[model samples]
Target: MPSSKKKSSAKKSATKPLLISAGAVLAAITLGIVSWQATAPAGTGSSGAPAVAGPRTDPAAELKALARRESGDKLAVGRADAPVVLIEYSDFKCGYCGKFARDTEPELVKKYVADGTLRIEWRNFPIFGTESEAAARAAWAAGQQDRFDAFHAAAYAAGSKEKGFAEHRLVELAREAGVPDLERFTADMAGGPAAAALKKDQEEGYRIGVTSTPSFLLNGRPIAGAQPLDTFTAAIARAKAEAAQR
Candidate 1:
């Protein structure tokens, strides 16, 4: 009896760390969802109302480590070794995502990407439904030909989402984005690789509790919604300073 009791105690002790780790993950995800709900834009399908405030605190280290920083990442812009990285998880069908793409992204690219101070990595996080998933795959296919940015722009252009992301529409967008081989683009879009890539991105977003479109992580600091340009600039400045220190 004494030996059995000791073994039971040892087993409980062994499970404690695993339990703690799981709890931490849950807590982080809860915080991320709350933060996003707090700051998400009105009509963005997150809160369905105007944003009240921004993130309450910086994200956990586990969330920050989500940056891929891969040199050959086709869906990313700026130098691979840039001091700061901004990870954007967005749905192509999202209006606010389009707003960010059209209004704010260009400025960011011109200022930060051109200077090599920041890298922007895109993750396909379709939440609307099948069309959103198809659009995401098409974007990934466009990236195969080094045309992700162009495809993104064409897809997010005003009135583009209204046209819907049907197979024909996606192909048309690819043509507009200057994807060289329409045949190859179509094939790749329907291929396993695109699905795998989309799955990886979706899993990452869900793990970090991204319940809305256009959620961002700047050096692991969560910033929800399509906020003003100054919000991003300020965050970038702070992230840059921190990176310089590290």
Candidate 2:
């Protein structure tokens, strides 16, 4: 969804939709409607021509509650109390996700995260394969040592995914990220906590009907794919204004 040439990987979940409440059902329906527009090939509309922006929709309250604003969350950046929270459901093996990490995210961090205006939270929704799951676990393990950000940057660096995320490769990444305790890193990566954390993220993504990689929720407004920087900036501005009203 980043470009006409690039498309997101579809998640293969066998489970049915987990809409237990009216709010959850509405959230799912809202995402289902907007997701098509959000993932429409860049520069093209349903009629196969350049697309124009559509009227914005109200944020879904149920989705907004998905933001885990824990002050000590290691996989997040910026103040926990930031007015706008961008929750990203992404796979480590997703090329578009890497593009966002390399190109767009740093700018957002510089412009918004630095000022306590936006908080970006990471959700490891690994749908690619075993390697993706391994990488997610490894990332959670890195967070244990307060090195999640460094590890994330390293893992998403240019051409990093070309090398598969095998056990040895994960160890190499841990070293590159400067995780001080190699023995502990390996233990944590293979431990139960890492698996549980990965499951929690994956389940949340599935429940929200996130069918593709790099899906995002900006203050409860669904934004699919790796959209341009301006799209995110405008959404952040709107969310911030709405937060002020509340």
Each candidate's lDDT (Cα)?
0.86, 0.84
Q: Which stretches of candidate 1 lie over 4 Å from their true place?
A: 1-59
Cα lDDT tens digits, model 2, 15-85, are: 33221233454466477545744665787743366755664343365578678899999889999999999
RMSD (CA, Å), candidate 2 to true, equals 12.7
Q: What 10-residue stretch in candidate 1 is worst by lDDT?
A: 17-26
- In model 2, the runs with Cα more than 4 Å from the true position are 1-59
For residues 1-246, what per-residue lDDT tens digits would candidate 1 score against the true structure?
A: 999999988988977421123344445676765566465565452314443364435445546667778999999999989988999999999998999999999999999999999999999999999999999999999999999999999999999999999999999999999999999999999999999999999977885677777888888777777877998999999989988888
Q: Look at candidate 1 and give me any clashing residue pairs.
A: none
Give the 10-residue window scoring lowest on summed lDDT in candidate 2: 11-20
Clash count, candidate 1: 0
